[model samples]
Target chain A: MAQNDSNTKDMILSLNSIEVLYDSVLLAIKGVSVEVPRGGMVALLGSNGAGKSTTLKAISGLLKAERGKVSRGEIKFDGKLIGDILPQDRVALGICHVIEGRRVFDHLTPDENLEAAAPISMSRAKIKSEKERMYEYFPRLAERKSAQSGYLSGGEQQMLAIGRALMTQPRLLMLDEPSLGLAPFLVAEIFGIIQRINKEQGLSVLLVEQNAVAALEIVSHGYLIENGRVVMHDTAGALKENSDIQEFYLGGGEGKNFHEIKHYSRRKRWLS
Target chain B: MDWIFLSELTVNGALTGLLYSLVAIGLVLIYKSSAVPNLAQGALTMTGAYVVLAFSHNLGWPLWVAIPLAAVIMFLLGMGIERVALRRLAGRPIVMILMMTMGIDIFLRGTTLAIWGGSSRSVNLGVSYDPFFLGDMLLSRIHIVGAAVAIALFVGFLLFFRTRLGIRLRAISDDYLASWSIGISVERGVGLSWGLASVVAVATGVIWGEVQGVDQSLSVLLLKGLTVAVLGGLDSIVGAIVAGIILGILESVGADFLDPFVGGGSRDLIVAAVLILTVMIRPHGLFGRHDIERV
Candidate 1:
């Protein structure tokens, strides 16, 4: 970790050529570098097992629980190198990760779930107001607030998961597949809200999604990862315009699905 | 048939059931947060009683001072067990944790026996042994006081789950990953559960110790408490109390009526039977929640 990295200044997050390993074997991240400008929304677009989620987990200190560790390079949040901070302590530093699969406490109501996510010292008055703000941000959650989160629809649960993250009042919100398993309209609604939050509150968001088309619409820039290495990095507009991205990710060509084998073969040729 | 004796037995058993509920509640707290059955719960109960006995008798501390001091010590010991013993085995299989707690139970049993010796020692908390009459039934004053304390602690625990810290504990039990990502200190919540469980176990030990005396046999409480815990649905607090009362009544009535027909003691035997039956019939326990499987 470079203690005085002059280049990381003005950036909210800078992943400095980091590598990750699951267990003692199986390297999962192969020296990937990415950056999120202050208050910027960035997307990590990749197919399954491309290490996008692992990168976000690395940033949030969630990898330790899964027997994964940052084996090399540094993760600097707010220009400070990530250290031996517990996952819960990352909340104090304003890093909130809404993990994949809309993981809310099913036994609790949305209200309690939000309250549960709040810092221990958060006052009732502040929590109530923050909850109200969350409700305003997602009216669907407010309508279903009385019911247990288990009964919530996939879209509503994702909204509640995001709302719970917001209750922490985090400066950086890392979302893992927020659009997964949702209708197109609901995806647009969620992505639109995320865009609004980014613009209004200036909350830096690092969104990891396989749904490149939807993610590209809301994020300012995007990184395309293939087999643990970043293969492409560009502005959303440029990525959308790229011929390879069009055939594979943006769906202007091919069957609107990532041709994984073809893409891997192309990466092989490109690496050579 | 001694109908009056049966009714009296029922009442006494009900009060004893409350004490068992108190002990079972301790087990539920640990299993609730960590999803691991704490086999050491009975050892904790026995250790708590001996600590109080040592303080009040050997150290010559006042009864009022001895119990609370013992409670505080047990609380720290419980948390220390989590931090020092359990935390080291984090992310291991549930079976490993299960074995770890069993090891702790054995360790606690040996430490208490080594320090206090195996002899049964009684601590006089000044409860009157004179049997009091109520509607043609006899009641011990100590049983009434024990029931009162158990009820108060149960009420306190009931109120606790509604608070912020309590909600966090419940949330952690529901989803460990989500809890950590949401900023909940899962480790602390688990530690607190152990601490609270230890505190309740101490209360059970003190109340029961007053009547039965603290002995190596008191460690059998783990079996009794485990039966109540399993019967109540290991995760449910209210279930523990309900199961405790039921077990108490059944034990008392069985001892009175069936023990004579059988060879000798059947009080503890009944609990073991119920534990086995509950597992075979309803593995989730009566009040325990089924896994909230996301469809």
Candidate 2:
């Protein structure tokens, strides 16, 4: 159950043998378990359809929107069973999700997007200062704060997406694919800000990404998933050097032909 | 034709158009937040007028008390409709949701008829039924009040869009899932939108009822509002207002000149033609947001 341990108090998010299904028929996640300590950044790395996004959705209670349900297992946020809470209520509890594809409101200006993200209970002064803090993290957003978000470039839109999440002043931030379709330089820049936010604000994060190298560089721990099940979990440094991850994910290891890499991935030790 | 007569007709048409805009705005608000066409909006309007009648005439309440009370009741009714009927139908196909709204419309109409009887009733808003002169053109006071109130409501909505709650509504309309993930209650937002829209519907009905007696025929006004919404873009408030005015003018001018040549009541025909043409040309409406899909 991963409960009653002395260190469990420090765990910001914990999923114990969680199983997610779509339409009550198709299983998307099968007996997955993971944990994120308070103030620690954890990355979930996987290929497409590996259920990384689904895991984030389940933790944030966003699965109900897509007709997906956690048919089995439980998810806890800050030691509370949050699997049954609504997505909006989850935000009041200081958990915010930056969904994939940077879904900013197209008709609104960047400044307005931040305002919408701010909780209704927050005073105007708090909202304004939080917005200013976000602008400091992404100065490019400051330059385009008044422009309609839909017209912003891809990098700018991604910045707005993260900045919007930051406006909630969350204790735990879950981001899905912040690096998708972004250039390497922009990806590094965004990750740097994420790292700075985590360090300075003592915020916990659960990041899902396909860019393992960039994600691993900032994350404290990393978990590898394939076909909705966790195949490996270790410190970021260990996973970066693991033979299987080196060959299959990092594109490392010497003399590994394409066929050998594919064979190795197919028969991973954890899969058995 | 005399220039004064032409100007009078134009002014009258514009005033009537503003009323249409009032009705269409309610539909646009519901569509924007909930993505439901809200076919029942017209019925809501009819019911609102009847509620006022029940209060003022049957219950012997003053206009001041009855109007505000009726608006409050209609607002709750709107929220109830969203919570009980539309909430269950969330995430359904758009067509199915729209059909449900039609069913609601039928239900409301039948209920109103059963409770209030089918006979027409006159509503007194306490305004003097005197004709005022604008230069040489005679104007009805009711039409003038209708125009003034419609414009006021339109301005109020524009100001609303600038507030924090308005931003939440706009955010939900832009992307439901994104808004939901960021702590906005999408359901509550949609429900509130319905509530606000119903308040507008009630106002529209009261004003409209003062001009034309309240009866089952008032529901036909929904067709006019729908025509305006379709021509202007179903999701655009600005488009609805502008299209309403334009249709109103077209009906006024066409009824006077063109109707004599092509039988009676060419206004409906003209509005229908314009709706079809607008759909064929600019389906997104004059100011409606066009979805840009990125691969």
Candidate 3:
């Protein structure tokens, strides 16, 4: 609430007083505010159950289905009141949410899954060109084009999910928990891909990650979310240098090991 | 049965089985995509038969024009069900959806009987071809053409699932949230699947009407089609076709051999029993995905 006084420009997406709850009992997210400008990456960092996922779902219109109503909030995407928009409409407007769990269509072949994510208006030639671009982005997916996504290894599925999102040609690609259940090498690899996507394609990203340190290292800005609220917001470099953030949020281990350094005592998690 | 008789019966059953598969395939598609068994699938088939009767008999349209027209009408009816009933229950429990379809079945049957006047009726398209004979066996041109059309459709669906649009439909069936986030219109996909199902149902109805004649009991006749879908595999399209043929032959032979021992109306009981056994043995139906992983 105090951070509202410091006005910021260059906002691509703005959430003013976003509050989401699953019934009255589960106050999954509370009065969370965030702003992401076009062509920049911002991380919403928190541990599990810290309402990071809830915030992403709210922005994605997934919360509406789960009875998680936005009791009070205004979500403006590209300066439009997009709070009431449907999930598919949001994608037509170029906001792709790369959810966690790599939930691609397991029964479908990898190529088919990629085609499903492609925009409906794309011509055959454009589809082929997009396919070539995806292959260039992830050579491993190209190798297994005919195989079912169910049989793909964990890392490959993660690559496929991101590749599928990119096929939509989205403006703001919101990634939820990109670093979960990955080896350090793969985590680094994914983060590197995100960096390239933002820099080379000029794609805006609102990345929510439990691996705070790694996420903060790649993004221009960071928000520390705990108990459904944004507790800290600053330049990624400033948050990286903050001692309390470093010890508690980022962990003392290598920048990718926030899962090991998590502490759960400070917030009234059930209440908030 | 002797070897010659057995071989002839097997061929007869197999041809009939293919027709059963055609009828069952649409039910599987609607069930897999919409997760509703659509008991009204039978009613849809009946409606298609009625449409044919209306066009060919009442209006004196050519059979060529009547058949496709009937199918198109049934397709629109399927879309109407999706808009009127299924759309309202999106994201609700699977049971609630099933109950809603049951209500649809009742409404459709009542409306049909009221309009068509609760009486048995027969329709014959004025194709003056003689029945072809093969070694003391009689086969009509309609049966051969019907069987061929069914097989072609089955192959077409196999190819369709490989296409981009089919992949999106399958994706929504697998995970709604994942598909939606990637810009797949779940509502539209489900509606399309229902429309496809109705097309198959209408095709089966036309063929069945041509073969056995149409009646007010035509909806009840779809019970056998449902049996094929359940026995072959609930969600598996190929399974439904296979099961349909298998059941058709089995029921045919059972009626020929075992009906006298069990008394009259034994075929229905046998089909129901076989369906129950298949479901109990493999709850997902044969060839369906056995494991569902949740995280």
Task: List residue ranges in candidate 2 displaced over 4 A.
Answer: A1-4, A254-272, B293-295
Worst 10 residues of 3 chain B by lDDT: B286-295
lDDT of 1 by residue, B201-220 (tens): 88989988987999988878
In model 3, the runs with Cα more than 4 Å from the true position are A1-9, A21-27, A252-272, B58-60, B127-131, B264-266, B292-295
Strongest candidate by DockQ = 1
True contacts kept of 2: 0.78
Task: Say which prediction, candidate 2 or candidate 3, comes out ahead on DockQ.
Answer: 2
User: Clash pairs of candidate 2?
Assistant: none
Per-prediction DockQ comes to 0.73, 0.71, 0.56
How good is the docking of model 2, as DockQ? Answer: 0.71
lDDT per residue for candidate 3 within A205-235, as digits (tens), equals 9999888878888999988887787777788
Better of 1 and 2 by TM-score: 2
Candidate 3 is graded, for docking, as medium
* lDDT (Cα, 0-100) at A24 in candidate 1: 70
For candidate 1, give the lDDT of residue B127: 90
Cα-based lDDT for every prediction:
0.88, 0.88, 0.79
